[model samples]
Target: MNDFDIKMIKKLILKGQWLLSEHALDKLLERNLRIVDVLTSILNGEILEDYPDDPRGHSCLILGKKDNKYIHTVCGFQNKSLVIITSYIPELPKWIDERTRGGKYHE
Candidate 1:
């Protein structure tokens, strides 16, 4: 999205100021994803979509890779901190590529 959002996300990662939502944590565990995997993905990923008008405030979808598999992370801002809304591996029948979904380019 904007430089400020990107900078804040990076800062959150560097300072360990982000937290996973309960639902997000559950999904990670259900999908056998590790916290480090999600973090690494975010640290090295690219923003795929932006939702500045999200009811929860500004947020974005990030696409990242881990172990050759692609991971999608939904990040949002809350109380001056970054929140991991959700994280999951991209699946077929929905995702067309690492940066696309349902025939639409997310980038």
Candidate 2:
């Protein structure tokens, strides 16, 4: 993501200007994740991937850690509102680390 996009996301986060989609909420519950986990992840996470051409507009994948677990959060923007598309913990054979994937990397 660009600096502008990151800035916008950070602003929304700081102002509590984001919301989770039903699907995202369901996933969170299924994974035993809490709202605070999402928020904390957003506040301190690192953007690992960017999707500027997403059909839903600009979005990015963030890598965060909570309770010693790596949480991957997919976030997008809708009408200037930060939308939580999905969130889950990274598993083996897919992720090498919280910030690095197992396959080839993309810039």
What lDDT score belongs to each candidate, Candidate 1 first? 0.81, 0.79
Give a tens-digit lDDT track for model 2, residues 1-107.
33435567778989888889999999999989997888787777878888888887777998777767778999987665788999988765577667656765423
Q: Predicted candidate 1: what Cα RMSD to the true structure?
A: 2.9
Candidate 1 lDDT over residue span 1-107, tens digit each:
33336656877898988888998999999999998999988888888888877787777988887778789999886676789999988876578667767544333
RMSD per prediction, one decimal?
2.9, 2.9
Instruction: Identify the runs in model 2 with alpha carbons over 4 angstroms from their true place.
Output: 1-4, 103-107
lDDT of 1: 0.81
State which candidate has the highest lDDT. 1
lDDT at position 57, candidate 2: 71
Each model's backbone clash number: 0, 0
